[model samples]
Target: MNTHMEAYYQKRSDIYNHVRNASTYEKIAYSFLMACFTGIAAQIVIPLSWTPVPITLQSFAVMTAGIVLGRKYGVLSMILYCLLGLVIPWYSGMTGGLSVLMGATGGYFLGFIICAYFVGSISDKFPKSRKFIGMTGTLLIANFAAIYIPGLATLYLTMSSQGVSLSLSQLLMMGLVPFIFGDILKVLASSTFSKLVMPKEE
Candidate 1:
């Protein structure tokens, strides 16, 4: 049984290595596909009455891209997503253009890129991060550092510029608190999905 399991893992490892070391064209294609996946996920939005930020599957897609594609290609995927989104109505609420990127939720778009790179870097540098617990921890940290910080900052600045005076507590309530539960769920899901699809290092 042990030998069989080892063989199975070895096969998976080989497949993963093949994809990781794929040709430049193949990597570009994969990055483009991930960008498209993010666009699709952005459409799965649950809007909040108070906050401009919507709950979307974008974080899941971003984290998954990082875990699966590693640091380099993961960043590429997010860059492609952001750039293409400027012209395509693929952002949340099916809205697009520079205005959307300059809006309250714009920081999250930047966060997506940074989050992907941060998660991907950790996943690549620490092989253990491919495991469930490690991946989940990494995702959680990335969410706070790479996602929420910039997200909240941009939200505050944008709202302030529009003459909306909100306290820091209120900003947290709108931009951070409401999304905590859902973000936790997304972290778990992203970790699980990543572990299932990513092979254990031989």
Candidate 2:
């Protein structure tokens, strides 16, 4: 029994390595393609009350990518997308380059990467659970951390720089309040898709 168990473990390891090696290039390519797709999606405007950065569905795409691709690939796709936005001029929108990184909307873009990893990690950890529960919880936690915090910070800084003084209540209304419903919808839609398309456990 001990020998059989050892052999089983070894075989699994070997298979994992073989699969990794075989799919490395394809994974890389897909990650990059997804990133590009993300950038293009971002360019499509969905203007919101918060700022010029409209409430785009690209965040949903990023979240879904993470749940589907797992951690490393999800993060890779996000990084690739950001790098492409920095490098490829045509990939960006009305503004381009690292400038976008500094913009008010940048936090959400950055959040997309973090959100993906968070959602992916949680889903991967808790397989065999109901899809909505896993996806919703992960997404809520991730987006709250990755989007709200940084978004507020960016808004504060931008406001301060612009000398636009506003109370916390006003700030919340302007920065966070407008997008909650849209974000929730995005989370629900993305969670559903991720749960459906994700692979079943062995």
Candidate 3:
């Protein structure tokens, strides 16, 4: 029930923002525009062997958006970003639309936004903590939520659609196992950078 409400709000919060917060035309434009820009910036492709989805930096921007814009705007930015990728060729590989949304990597792509919200909201709200534990926890949780779930789910669905019999182990091998290290690195990097730019105290 909680998850359902979050999903419901996550889907439509952008509309709410537009209705209540459009006090100035410039604010409205900037918010929407920044959302699109960050979305495009996040569509990065990582070249690798035997991996279905190229590691993209979309999550980084998603995280940054949340930290900078706060929960509502950060999610809105991601929402706009996703919409653009769906309607225009602005995502990784310059791809977009329903086809892309229905594509194998789409789930992870969507996951980026969710992760950003979780990571950003937590870090922004609770900035004070021991450097090692809080930061690491922040990064770890964010990455797990934002990246791992969606990435693995996408791989599972895509492979299943292709009529491939993917065992739990095989699925982990292809989807989760390979990216753990890299995601850890991203978490560390994002945490460090976030701390520097937007210190919790402010």
State which candidate has the highest lDDT: 1
TM-score-wise, the better of 2 and 3 is 2
The model with the greater TM-score, 1 or 2, is: 1
What is candidate 2's lDDT per residue for 4-53, written digit by digit as tens? Answer: 96776566546534433558798788687778767776776567645655
The residue ranges of model 3 lying beyond 4 angstroms of the native Cα positions read: 1-34, 40-43, 129-133
Off by over 4 Å in 1: 1-4
Cα lDDT, all candidates: 0.91, 0.70, 0.67
Report the number of backbone clashes for model 2.
0
Candidate 3 has an lDDT of 0.67
Could you tell me how far off, in angstroms, the CA of residue 64 lies in candidate 1 after the best superposition?
A: 0.3
Arranged by TM-score, best first: 1, 2, 3
Give the TM-scores of the predictions, in the order they appear. Answer: 0.95, 0.80, 0.75
Itemize residue pairs with steric clashes in candidate 1: none
RMSD of 3: 10.2
Candidate that beats the other on lDDT, 2 or 3, i.e. the better one? 2
Better candidate number, 1 or 3, judged by TM-score: 1
Give a tens-digit lDDT track for model 3, residues 78-119: 777778777778777677788777777778767877876776
lDDT of 1 by residue, 59-112 (tens): 999999998888999999999999998999999879899999989988998999
